[model samples]
Target: MRKINYKDITNQQLIDVRTQHDYQAGHLKNSLNLNPGNFKTYATYYLDLNQPVIFIVGSEEEGHLEELSESANELGFNQKNGYLLIDEVPKEDLQTTETILAEDFLNKSDDFILLDVRHPDEITRPAPEKNLVNIPFEDLVNDYQSLDTSKQIFTLCGSGNRSTAAASFLESKGLNPKVIEGGMKAIQEIGK
Candidate 1:
């Protein structure tokens, strides 16, 4: 487990090991939210083992970093480039990404590209809108080039977890992506 200052971790992939609500409020730019419980599964499926990754936890107390690092190691992510305590980073340095509510997104469906990043099994049931493009989260980094960069992308997932991660990845690639807040779950509730 390596430790580094936030200033030193430049231009590397950052994974935020914090709660979804905390992550949604603010996080380091280009950082992907990977809840501790889901870190191993998501990392194994979507992340590149060879890419250097920096983990940022909400705090240092109570073994948060230890637990997160243990999970990462279990998934074969042996090389942890660095770990940072979130409190050490300045609030101004943290950035929040744009999000569109499910209701608003459904109402103005034609205004943007609805990119569903959920797995095929999750998307088997069709979306209320017909203009959705399915590119599972795991396939996004490699398949993003196939999308039309001119259009604004609104990413969706089962909930907002995967979508937030997908949006961050897209933003890192210089593409603008707005995550749909609450994702398909919110859309379903609105429909109900």
Candidate 2:
């Protein structure tokens, strides 16, 4: 993998390696916002190993592109199309979205569709029943179309990280799903 200009790029998946706040502020349209910390374990679930991919890296991750691409290769995704410096992307090409707090979500969850974005193996605790859907964050890329567009969707994962990724992807698809702040851990702490 090597550094490449965004203008010369085409037809490759864009993976954004920015913090959730920076990502929600602005990102390449249709790109998936994945946390770099969980890139190997969680990223694989959302990616197709056969497809060529390019990462749009944040300032903090800029120095680690080679390492990231190496990780991608070791994970069996060898078709890396290189990476882009987030600073180089045109402002017009970026988009933004919103997030919701866990506390706020609890108050009005019944009125919204609750999307449990955690992988099945991660579910060790009970979640609220009303309107809850357990579509793992990885599957949402393909299954988002099946969701009802009329109701608001609240995204949840173990912590707030993966849910933000899910919420950002949903936002790109034109739905306004709020990432439940701090995810299940926050809910559990609040319950306790």
Cα lDDT of model 1 by residue, 119-173, tens digit: 8886754665656799988788789899988889998888888888888778778
Tens digit per residue, CA lDDT, model 2, 1-192: 688898977888788988877887888887888867777776676778899888888779887777777788888996756888889988998877667766677778356788998878879976777799888877887898888889988888887778888887787677878777778888888788
Stretches of candidate 2 above 4 Å error?
42-45
Cα-based lDDT for every prediction: 0.78, 0.81
For model 1, state the Cα shift of residue 62 in Å.
6.0
Error of 2 at 110 (Å): 6.5
Model 2: number of clashes? Answer: 0
C-alpha positional error of residue 187 in candidate 1 after TM-score superposition, expressed in Å = 0.8
Q: Model 1 Cα displacement at 166 (Å)?
A: 0.7
lDDT at position 22, candidate 2: 84
